[model samples]
Target: MTKADFVRRCRWLIACAVLFASANAWADEKSELKEKALKLNSITGKDPIDGKIKELAKDAENTKKMLKVAAEVAKEKPQPFQYNGAFILARAARELKENEIALEFFNISTQLAMKVKSASKLLESFDGKISLLYEQKKFDEAEKACQELLDLEIDPKFEEAKIIVLEQMIQFKAKQGKIEEALKLTDNLMKLDEGGWYFVRLKGWVLHEAGKYKESAETYLDTIKKLSENKRLKEEEKERWIERTRYILSSVYVDMGQIDQAAEQLQMLLKKKPDHPTYNNDLGYIWADRNMNLDESEKLIRKALEEDRKQRKKEGVEKDKDNAAYLDSLGWVLFKKKQYAEAKKYLLDAVKDEDGQHIEILDHLADVHMALGEKKEAIAVWKKALDTEPASKRDLKRLEEVQKKLKAAEGK
Candidate 1:
């Protein structure tokens, strides 16, 4: 699923919990404040809060009373109810975007859980803390929490939490650009998990990040075969993994300077999903980048753009015809074919849509301007790109190229 769909699917479980109307916990339970909250719920009768006004206690007065009672129970009860109350409060705090309070309450809930049972029963709750920290971009804190969690002797029931924490720690490390650290965690996970195509696919990703193109290519090829043979994964799941592995394989083979192998991989994908916009764009960009099959590349890029527009419209969203990356592909292809003015239009559209911060898009725009003899515009764009590029070897090389272009232009 797309990111938006994933969020929608899980939103109710996290933020908008349907308060238990069943004889579960809340129904069999009663405190003075809890009764007050329920009374308000009956009176309100579903004006808002999804027919469950008890989720918010209807108004501030009852909400305040509920908070006080929850706090008291958390201190005085020291058992199952305290754990339950803290979890509810944490969910409330999360909805309010009070990250610190949410984390504090979740940790409190876990601590209270240990008092109820000899072994920890709150790793799932502890997971809420990790997610909150990651959402707030507290990567270091999140990773530290992961390490602390792994250090604990979690119950066999909660052993699955270990895998979750490890994956989260790896994600945090990767987000902070510590790819090698993430690779080590991936290796650990591979050992812990039952052997599957998933780990093999992840190994390919790590190899690609480390710039081991030949190894990445080999692993990705293996990943496809393993994905096909894996009976545990559903057909849709296998399809996604296989397609992604094939795409990566093509890119890796291209980096290995085996263009024929790259072409064959892409051709294989297109045969399965002929109108796949992403594959069309990737193949188009590859041929454009290599300055081969210029006419065919143009056709493929245009088709990709057209398909994207149709798909977006069908999905009930704006068509976004000026998508910067696709425009860049088309513009670059046109420029390679010496169609300078036509290329200039598409490049400017790309820069406009990308808002001038995308390094490669700005570079393409600057080059187009230079080709059009618009020296002043070209120099300005090059300087902007130079300032915006990040501190990486590839980006530093981009900076140097921009600097060289600026210097050469000024000299004339």
Candidate 2:
């Protein structure tokens, strides 16, 4: 063959070989991508064929790079792609704690998701914003965002979100110490869903703090009953509700001077949580004050003190002041047993170390000092007690009587 003809034939063969290799490589890549797309689709529960098509389309940059290399020797083609890439990117940004990036992406996602009519995606974007505001402690901003969501009529479908928003409002009001506003919010919350036991419990706490003890007790009982009726409540939750209700009932009964009822409720509570320090101390102190169950009271009080010490040690907490009620109970019990000197030490310590300037602690201290013949100290403490603002007419009368005795003793 001629030299030019041989060179031309050789060039044609090289070009054909290059084109054949490029086509085979493209086919192999396409098959591998299809397999990957199918696996992702199956796992994600999306349409396999559509997923494959979208994957090919969205990876245009990578595909373009491949196609450019192939185009040097053969024709290149593009694949179709359609997926919420912006939404996915936004979610990734949020997960990484890149709030600025997340905000940008979320805005884009919201716009795109709205066009797609994806309610769930739109809700997610709003929730992300709400959560960010809340995490920043921007309560007013968070509330505004929550209100916006509510205005969108999302609450009817997102009942959990609605409940959360209501709870947040209640918490915000409570934290501000706006008890009346909190109660009003609680009432509105209850009207929205009367069967929600959490709202009932919140209402009870509000009433308790407002000194409506009887109403608080009734609400607590209702909360307990409602929680018990909820099949979705875990066993632990039900037990907690019962324990809380019983504890509140006991406290209210004690406040109302219904000692027998208080004792009954406390007994039930103690049975469930035998070593509960506060309950043990309160029940023991109550019994001692009533001059009933002295032996049991002493035992319970000692146990409570031990538990308190253990808990304080664990939590690295220090109570610089004495527990006035605990000391008063111990002192009164010692006086009942005629251990006058020992009673005087505890009562004096209680009066000296008590916070809140408790009148009852001072009264006990004065009475103990009188019994111990420390007449001057007794008179001083009695006068101090009389100076305190009495909560009731009975307390005022008692104060007056104590003062009269102190004056008579001083005169003598």
Candidate 3:
């Protein structure tokens, strides 16, 4: 070869050798990582693997190292070990709010479970995947996951898992406004266990979401009747279910603009659990919003706040924070009574609470501001309300009303 060609060949060989050495080094490092993770899993003392993960994951650098080792172990380990390790990692990561990593491990666990034909593990993994997707509002992906689980030829021993998956599918369809599809899924759910009273209640919920108020009310009544006659349920359980269904039926009546029918349900519940914070607050808010029973509404709302404080204390909560929704109810009642200054105080405090950053609460506060002749403040509050995202169709309609209010105030 010529000298220039020989020199170029030598340089190319040197480059290839360096690349080979680097690749080997990386492979050795990866093997060591997998070895370390497998060793960690085998170390047994009061869940040493879990403890190590929790400790190591506290720091960002350590977390990355831990996740790398975990991923390698999950992907390369043998059956049972692979599934268990991946599941543990996914659970820990989810608790730590490392959602993307959690999702990856969950998918790995699911694949391993399917390969091993472990029906229980498959169900658990799918549950995790579906829950995370739902929380992230990835509804399309969640529905697909639910449908995949439903299509699985799972053992009859795991029929309960199938029922749960079917229930979730119904909810998913209902949320998407596919009322007929949701209703059909509910029928399939009911077929899994004919005596499942809860499934009947689920149908009531679907009907309510579909705006079939009369049918929803009828379904809830049937559920309540079934609960009353159910020999299987404990008395306490029966009462709780009946109370809840009655409360739901009240909401249906409210939506149908049958205020008297709604009041009857709340009164029945209050007679049984007079100090229930939610029952008191809901009935009070309904009355106050309609400018009916103002005095009774004020009393009920005050009682709600009192009971809520007591309940929080009993639960051993460190902070005795007032519920923002209850605060809004009280403030609205006061505003209805022309106590604008007092209403503003409670509404301001309501808006300060973490759960109080809602369009409805802001709308109430803006109205109070307007009543107090704080026109600029009202305008500012309304603009903030406009910026807030709506959570429901009702909220969207309320937003339109708020927009019109803003325009009128601005024009004035």
Q: Which tens-of-lDDT digit does each residue in 1-412 have in candidate 3?
A: 9999999999999999999999999888777756655554354444775676566556556556667666655554353256666776676677676788889888887887888878888987888888887777677778888888777775775665677787887887887788999998787777876876898899999999888989999999888988888999999988988988999999999988898899999999999999999999999999999999999999999999999999898998765789999999999999999999999999999999878999999999999999999999999999999998787667888999999999999995
lDDT of 2 by residue, 121-152 (tens): 66666666656555555556666555655555
- What is the lDDT of every predicted structure here? 0.73, 0.67, 0.85
Top-TM-score candidate index: 3
- Number of the predicted model whose lDDT against the real structure is largest: 3
TM per candidate: 0.64, 0.50, 0.76
* Distance from true location, Cα of 169 in model 2, Å: 9.3
TM-score leaderboard ranking: 3, 1, 2
Writing each residue's lDDT as its tens digit, candidate 1 over 1-412 gives 9999998889866654555444355545546566543343233222333334235634545455465555455455423344555666665566555566667777886676665643444675677788888778788988988887778774676665576677777777766778888888787767766557777777777777677778888888888988899899889988988888898899788778787789889989999998988888888888898888999999999888888888988887633454577888999999999998999888888877635467777888888888999989998988888777353345666777777878998894
Clashes of 2: 0
